[model samples]
Target: MEELLAQIERALRIGLTVVVAYLVALWLASIWWTFRDIRGRTTDIFLQIAATLLVAVFSFPGLLIYVILRPPKTLAQLYEESLEEEAFLQGIQVHNSCPVCKQRVEGDFIFCPWCQTRLKRTCVRCDRPLMLRWKMCPFCAQAVYTPGSGEAQPQVAGGQTSAIPQLRGADPEDTGPGTRPQIAARR
Candidate 1:
């Protein structure tokens, strides 16, 4: 009977050793997973070390905690989102819109194409398109005469004057494509 009991005791010791070894291996795996997961999610050294230690200490429960608290988006996703936002902001900042018709217009456009509303006036000396409110021309440092500022109007064949504002290009004689309403004065 004593020999049989001694044999049973030896069998129990071997069983316990195997169980403990398996648990230790599983715990080590948990630690490694924690380290790898944290490294991929963040760039901070302290966070990676802290997560690894926590998972090692608590084993399975610590891994669950880290998974729940990690960032929802990956690094690549964050980068793409930032780029899209930057492009949208730049478009809003650079483009100019017409006030009368709310249509997008170029920077040097003298009048709104859709509304025929005079956006800017012609500069007297430099003959460049000037902004509506400016008293002086930016190109030639010359004073400008605003259209509605009660300036003298040259009469044609009869007493009628040119009511429609003419768009001048590089030279005063050159008239670019415009929807300017001009009346043919009778000779």
Candidate 2:
């Protein structure tokens, strides 16, 4: 029984050794893949290679040190940093137009000259004018303007009734509910 117990202890130690060695190799490979400089040799590559070698020779503690010393930057963080640099190099100014007359207006201006229409921009969907304080479109229940193509058009006109007749063809009883209205008959 004592001999069997000794054999089990030896097996456990060997298994642990193999697992530790495999983990060390995997970590080293990951570091190599992550920091491999495809172009000219970079400081990051050199540091990672050195850390990998240290971990391979020494083990878990060395790998722990490497992880603590250097961490990867997220894509969003890198993009934001680049944007900040660009904004710093090239100054950015926003241009706004008068809602009523569609005339160009200064970003700081509060009123418009051409239409004297309160210098407000109306929501294309609901035709409700939005204030500078609004974060969203009040009329259409949409988010604020983004840098893209022009606004979408509304399906129906507001407040005004059309002078044209409602029906452009024979009565529904004469034709059928599914039949399309005739445009020439109205003329």
Candidate 3:
């Protein structure tokens, strides 16, 4: 009867030893997880060490506390979010600048306020602002006249100016794929 009691005590002790070893391994794994997770979430080495030590000292309960206090987003997630916001702002932002003075300007300004340079001209038919280099007003399809040139843009069908430039002395009636027409060049 004494031998049976001794055998039962030895079996219980071995089972307890295995369970303690398993718990220690689990505690170490929790500490490693905390360290790896904190590293991904933050660039601070101190925070990573603190989080790992917290789990190592207090085991599962410390891990729970660390989880509750950790950053909501990882470092990669925060960076990606910032990049997305920047792209969104750039897509909506309109960059306008004065060509003459190289200063920032509004999109609708016809003259540069800083240098008084004529940035655009007003369309005669539609009264909308047009760029100086535009040969015809896209809004009204009317020919834009140059301020000092002594020539006019030739009118095509529907009162729209022809984009094709005519030669110095080509006939207007010779407007075909093979024949080039002639008209006065508008400045």
The prediction achieving the highest TM-score against the true structure is 3
Query: What does candidate 1's lDDT look like per residue over 45-104, in tens digits?
Result: 998888888888878898888778877666677788987665444432245766666688
Q: How far is candidate 1 from the true structure (C-alpha RMSD, Å)?
A: 15.5
Candidate 1 local lDDT, residue 142: 46
lDDT of 3: 0.68
Sort by lDDT, top down from the best:
3, 1, 2
State the C-alpha lDDT per candidate.
0.64, 0.49, 0.68
How well does each candidate superpose onto the true structure, as a TM-score?
0.43, 0.31, 0.49
Give one digit per residue, the lDDT tens place, for model 2 in 72-183: 6544566789886654333212336655555776654434666553433444335466554454554444333432222232113211111111242244233322222442
lDDT of 3 by residue, 1-187 (tens): 9999999999999999999999999998898889889999999989889989999988899999999999999999999999876654432123466654567777667767897766666665466877666766777555555554312321221133223324311543333322212234332
Could you tell me the TM-score of candidate 3? 0.49
Model 3 misplaced stretches (Cα beyond 4 Å): 92-187
Model 3 clash pairs are: none
Judged by whole-model lDDT over C-alpha atoms, candidate 2 comes out at: 0.49
Candidate closer to the true structure by lDDT (higher is better), 1 or 3: 3
Q: Tell me the lDDT of model 3 at 20.
A: 99
Give the higher-lDDT candidate: 1 or 2.
1
